[model samples]
Target: MKIFLTGLGFVGSKLVTHLIQSPENQLRVVSRSPSATLPAGVHFEQVDSLEKVINWPTLIGDSQVVIHTAARVHVMNDSCDDPLEEYRKVNVRGTLALAEAAAAVGVKRFVFVSSIKVNGEETFPETPYKADDVPAPRDPYGISKLEAEQALQALSSSSGMEVVIVRPVLVYGPRVRANFYNMMNWLFKGVPLPLGAINNKRSLVSIYNLVDFIGVCAKHPRAANQTFLISDGQDLSTTELLQKMGRALGVSVRLLPVPVSMLKLTASIVGKSGISQRLCGFLQVDIEKNRRLLDWVPVCSVEEGLARTAQDFLTGRRA
Candidate 1:
């Protein structure tokens, strides 16, 4: 089978690795630069602009599936004057362009990787998002992702191009970056962290498990026109998460019991209430629908996933 992937960021890269491991798949990647050190047996092209998309018509015309994992992730960089507009350009417009291109060429299926934030950043106590729940994005990134899902569904209706959307929460493991990186740095140093009093529950996904689920969706007949919220199916408090991470790093926690209210106040003054809230707040996803629909369960526990990540960190196997 021929599979085309757009985007080479963190998730995209991991997806490519998964595809390469599949013996029956021939993979092609499209990006702005074609100079990536991809695994053996993968093809590439450079897409300079939305108008300059390569012979995607011909490429996807013969492909079995197209997995769209490329996007401008949430950023605090200064280049974004209007974050909403910036998100729309790439996450929404670029996504539609790619989907339209695929549809034009008669691609069978298009799987979009979306964010859990499409439901909301923080999950309330009694109400977690179900597959049938309407999206309520609270940030530019989430809004763009939700908009893209809508566009793809419309395209699917008109062109008979099957669309499957997977919303994953806080994917972590090898080749992790940003927040996970900082978290690991602190854990590895055995420094005292101020997250002991954080009693909030959050859901996280292992990159391995996420990629595995995507592989199932790629060919599963039951996955057509479906949307899934994926995680390890384990909800954990922030303190429990930290403790597991510390254990994986072969270190004991030096947690300082600081009050959550004090942390919130400090974060607000510094304009980082969102990040602080994520570190010290409650956010969970209900994955029962995914389990029931696809009969899929995470193969690795959180502890096993964290151990792999810790090994990657110690052995320099990932960045």
Candidate 2:
């Protein structure tokens, strides 16, 4: 199989590594620069931007699958005047252009890596977001992704190209950045946090599991024209997660018993409401659809995944 992939960031780079392990598969990456640390045999194409019409027909020629992982990811303090329009330019318009080009070139499958935010920011305490749930994207990024999914589905119907959408919750692993990485750093340094009272349950995916599922979707017969919400299937509270991270780092977690209400109030006052919600909110996904339809299971347990992430952090390996 010939695979054309976009992006070389966290998930995409790992997926590229995994795909190249199979000698029968050939990999080509599209990026703005030719400086990616890809395997020797993998092909690389330099493209200015996904939003522009680049010779995609020739670029995607003979490719069986196009895995799209690039996007205008959500920005915490967006500087753009019209954030939604900015996101639409890349996430929606750019994605459709690539999909159309792939379809024109007879690509059989297009796997889109979407986010769980498409379902909503939060879930009910006991109820988890399902794959078929009505989309309620509250943020610009989520709305853009939802629109891209709709456009892709329509393109699939019209062009007879298989489209598979995989929505993954907070993916964490080696070389992770942003808030998760900061949390890991704080934990490693034995910084005391006041999240011991957060009792909300959240779902997260290990990069290993997400890449495995993407590979399955690339070739699985039942995965065609399907949407999947994937996770490790193990939900954890904030306190539990911190405890587990501490264990993985071989350190004793130092969490103060701060009241959840007080924490939220302080966060609101400090303009960190979003951070507070993520730390103390319920956001779990039901991944039964992927498990039942594709017979897919997470390759690593949560404990194992956490240990691996901590080890990578300690060793300074990108992994």
Candidate 3:
């Protein structure tokens, strides 16, 4: 099948590489600038104008599927006064424009890479997030992603496009950044972290697993107009993650047990209660839908993934 993908960033680059090597698929990538250095089989185009680039018949004329991966990711150090508006323009508006373009063309399938943040930050004991869960995005980025989901759903109904949304949590592997880099930096420095006492569970996904799921979504019959929350299916605590990462790095994890209350107080004083809550909270997701519908599970285990990630970090492979 011929597929067109937008955004050749980390996840997009990985997906494009896999698609290019696959004998069954032909891939094209669209970006704001024609600056992506992709593999031999992949094609690239610089699409500065969303409207002109996404005219349905033009964008999906020969393509059977279109995967929209381009978006303004959450910037932790952004200088924008209204980050939400900025996010809305790139995430929400760009998505809507692309969907309209896909609908105008004859594309049969449209896959959207959404975030699990659409369900909210933390999950409760009795109820983990499900596909049917009403979206309750708290932050600007999450809100923009959820808004894009809604807009895409509407387009699916009106445009007869098979829209599939995959919401993956904390995607990690080689060439990651932000919080994952922070964790790696701590490990590289061999710093004693105060996370032993925190037993909060979180769901994480390996990059390979996420890319595989997207491949399934592209053609699976049951994936039409469906939303899927994917993960590695292991809810590990902070300590467990640190320990595993340390093992992957050939080092012993050194965790100092500080009182949870004291840690919370310190975070509050620094106005980082959000960071504190995530560090000391439970956020588990149920991936039963992916298993039940598509019979999909992570092919790469956490141990394998972490080992690869550690090697990649040590080798200094940049995105």
Candidate 4:
């Protein structure tokens, strides 16, 4: 497969690296600014516009597959006046523009990396989000991703391009940042945490597993025109996650059995209600379809993945 990879951020960069390692595959990365740390001997095109794909046909020349993973993801303190519009500009419009260009260039499969938030912010323990669930995006980012998914489906129908959408829950692995990274830091340092009582179930995929699934979708026959919700096939509660993380970090876990109601109340007062929800909410995915349709199971167990991430963090800390 002559694959054209986009984004080159967290997921994209890891996906591209994984795909290119196969001797049977040919991969070319497209980025607005090339990373100096990309694997040696990798071929990538540096351009001025990743969002618009300026001169797209020539830029994407002769590629048979495109794995698009770019987006304006969640921001901490966004300064934008209309966050939804900003998100749409990159996630919806830019994705469609690139998809059309890829179709025009005769690309056969376009795998899009979407988020679990498209289904909603929370799920009941009895009702894990499936790929076919009606989207209930609770935030601007989720809404934009849902819009982009819809647009891609419409484009695929009209242009005869095979579109595979993969919606992954919180992705964590070696070098993961943001909340997962902070979780590690807190656990490793034995920071006082009120998360012990949080019994909410959340699904997380290792970057290894996510990249593996993306590679499968890029070429699997049944994956064409299909959407998949993926995870490690294991769900963890906030308390369990912290405990496991402490073990991985070789630290004794210290947690306060703070009541959920008190946590939410305090967070709301401090304008961090969203943080409370994240720490004490339910979000899980049904990956039965991924297994039944594609015969895909996560390549790495959650324990192994967490161990690797913890190892990397420790190595970095020591260095």
Clashes of each: 0, 0, 3, 0
Per-residue lDDT of candidate 2, residues 153-189 (tens digit): 9999999999999999999998888988898889988
| Pairs in steric clash, model 3 | 56-101, 56-105, 57-105
lDDT of prediction 3: 0.85
Question: Candidate 4 residues 1-319, lDDT tens each?
Answer: 8888887788988887798788788877877656658776667787666566667788678889999887888786678999999999889998988999999989999999998889998988767999998889988999999999999999999999999999999999888898888888888888999887987898989999999999999999999999999899999999999999889999999999999999999999999988888889888889999999999999999999999999999898899
Task: Give all TM-scores, in the order shown.
Answer: 0.93, 0.97, 0.94, 0.97
TM-score of 1: 0.93
lDDT of 1 by residue, 1-319 (tens): 7898887877788888888897999998877655469998888876775434656686565777999887878785436678988888888888898889888887899999999989987877656677678888888889989999999999999999999999999999977888887888888888898889888888899998898898888888899999999999888888898899889888888899899999899999999988788888777888887778888899889989999988888777333
Better of 1 and 3 by TM-score: 3
RMSD per model, one decimal: 2.0, 1.6, 2.1, 1.3
Clashing pairs in 1: none
Model 4: lDDT to the true structure = 0.89
TM-score of 2: 0.97
Candidate number with greatest lDDT: 2
